[model samples]
Target chain A: MHIPSWLLTFCEYLEQTASLVVLLPLGLAFWRWPRLPKTMRLMTVYLVFTELVLLASSLVELYRPAWSYGIWHFFTLVQTLLFFRIYYLTLSSPAVRLLIQFAAVGFTVFAFLDSLYLEGLQQVNSYTHVAQSALLIGLALLYFEQLLNELHITRLEQDPLFLVSTAVVLYFSGTVLLYVFVNKLSAPADYASHQVIYTLNSMVNLVQYLLFALAFWYAGRTLPSQSRP
Target chain B: MNSWLLPVMLATPVLLLLALGIVGFVLRYQRRLLRQQEQLRQVRDASQQQALEAALLAQEDERRRIAADLHDGVGTTLAIAKLHLSTLGQPNLTEEATALLDQAIGEVRRISRNLLPAALQKFGLPFALDALARTVPADGPTHVIIEQRGQPRRLDPKRELIVFRVVQELLGNGLRHAHAETIEVSVDFGPDYLSLQYRDNGVGFDPAAGDLPPAPGTRSGLGLTNLRSRVAVLHGTLRHDSAPGAGSKVWISFPIPYLPADQKPALTTSV
Candidate 1:
């Protein structure tokens, strides 16, 4: 395939820019440090972890490019754990919280197994991405159900957890398919030519971060809400 | 474009739209549930108010019947017996018997009046309240003062009874429980509202702890429950402030329905 150089450069810049965009939300999360609730504080931790992972991955890519996959494999598992904790705090149902616990355990084991045996550390972890998307999307659906059942949050848009859930649902659903074909897309022959494909992940990353920024902003200000029993 | 790329592009929007559609449906469904919950609350309140009104009206009817029995049936019989005793020939014996009869008649009259305030039906709430105050011992430890303000127009008959009962209960409570030295009761007839204020300098119970009414199944609890029901039925507001050592103050206001000037009564001001 004769991929254009300009097009390839554009995709590279876009991906790098998307990677760095985590700073915007990280800054907002720090600005509202004192008032962030437990769930939001967890989210801030997730943001910080993401930025660190991205930086370290880049550093490792320079000296030992193959080891970068291991860092990402670890990132995938931790991100799911954090999201599970966030949902656990916001949700009221004992049954759902129990489900989250079970799912968290199940996902941890699956992700490790997939990295060690199924996908290996050499290739993109498409299996882990797909599984993470499915799990988070399911959690997001449960959260939306919680919102309806509780009827406590009068303003859905202003609720930080709700915004975060919406973002999770949007990002995961929008990018799941692209991730499914990622291994084939990243084949060595087509890796340089098919840089445009990864741009989809960047676009969704943009949406996800903006939503997170909004979530952090709302967390800083006190909005009318009731504590879930 | 590769065969896999075409399917990914086509399916991504469908999946995104599916998620969006679910979110939108939830938003709409939640709003509807909220609306339904609000309507259910309003309905519950309305039915509760109606039940209270019916019970109160039935209570008043029973009181009226008992008063009539005391005044017409028992009181008349006692008076006739007193008249016959005075006709006895022995002067000393007649005098003693006649005095005892007089005491009996007076006690019956007092009981009858308490059961049903004739002044309340004939005169109005202010006259009835005045009569209520005079029933308390003037030289006793508790001294009650009644003050009426604004142009005292007549209210609905049932409303007048409620106002009178509220004052009666307050006075009764002051004498029985409050142990106050001075109790002041004020009624204001505003242009569109009727306000009642009662203040007592006594060993007050804590309103914050809900000791004024106490808990259910107690006498005070029943009294407060009844008082609250009456106030709620009229769509009125009730406020009570008190502490262990500090005095007690209660303020109640109701939206008044005014009567024409020609319908006003010409009752004397005497307590």
Candidate 2:
């Protein structure tokens, strides 16, 4: 496939910048640490962990390129667990929380299987990524249903969990396709596929971080939350 | 094998647009739901206000009936008894008995007037308020001072009654509970509003506690709650300024609708 060099450069810059945009939310979360609710605090922890993982993975890539994929495989599992914790805290239904607890255990087992047997550490684990996207997207839908059932939230825009769930749905659903074909298409010589993956994923990732920053900023401004969870 | 690079590139923007579209839809739908909720709340509030207004009107009607009965039936009967006693010319009938009969008649008249202020109905709020202040004896421990500002104009009889009741309660609470020494009431009539300021050198309370010192013994008598209801019906704003040991001051402002000159019939009076 013939791809424009300018587009490739833009995609590369966007990819590098998108990951660091998590700092916006991270700074806000820290600044408003005392005021944030349990869910928002948990999200802050995820943000911190993500930044750490990004830094660690970059270092590993420079030192040992072969093991870089292993770091992301670990990241996939941790990210799922953190999100489960976040949603579990916000969702009011006891049955849903229990279902999520079970889902957490189930996803952990699947992630292990994918790493050891299905897609090995050297591969992109497109199956795991697709599954993660589907599961998270499902959780986001459940959250939306919960919001509808409980209209207690007077200001939906300021609600931290609402903002976070939106980011989750958009980011996961946006990047699910990229994840699905990334393994097969990421051959060393397939420059066009790399551009497609980096460009699409980075754009959505930037949006996710910006939304996250807004959520954190709102949480900081209002101390006594109207949201039940 | 077909290269999916072209398809992926094309589909990615479409997917992003789809996600953006979903977010937009959710926002619009939620706002619509919220607007519906707000509209329902407004309807509920309006219904409640109507119910409250009806209850207050019924209470006033009842008061008027009771006052009429007391004055016409009870007072008249008492006066006839005094007349018959005087005509009997009995030796056993002492002067004390005659004096006590006069006091009883006076008491009945006072109670009847208290139930429904005929002065307020006949004259206006300012006149009724002045009459109320005069009820506080000059020799009494508490000295009442009434001040009026701007041109005096008559309001709707029902509205005057509401304002009268509010002032009546304030004075009653201060006299009965606080044992105020000097009470000052200032009434300001703006071009389109009426404001009242009441200050009493009484045992003031912490306004922050949001509690009134109980003035018991008057059942069906308008208390602070009823006072607030009356103010609400008038669409008036009330504020309190006081602390423990300091004198309490209350400021009330009620918007008065402008009645044009052609609409003016028995509306203006001397203060």
Best by DockQ: 1
- DockQ of the candidate models in sequence: 0.47, 0.45
**lDDT (10s digit) by residue, model 1, range B1-271:** 4556666767887988987888778778878877787688799988988988888878888888898898999899989988787677676878877788789889889988998888887888877887888888799988899999998778777888887888787778777777789999999999999998989888777554545545432223234556777787789999887776677888899997877767764343221
* Top model number, lDDT: 1
Q: Runs in model 2 with CA error above 4 Å?
A: A223-229, B89-97, B206-222, B258-271
Tens digits of per-residue lDDT for model 2, B49-155: 88888888888888878888989999999899888888888737646777888998999899999999888877778899899999999999999888889876778
What is the TM-score of chain A, computed separately for every candidate? 0.92, 0.94
Clashes of each: 0, 0
lDDT by residue (tens digit), candidate 2, A1-229: 4668887888888888997787899999999999988888988988888888888998998999999888899999999999999889888799999999999999999999999899999988788888898889888878877776666676677777778888998898888888888887778777767766877888899999999999998885653323442
TM-score of each: 0.87, 0.89
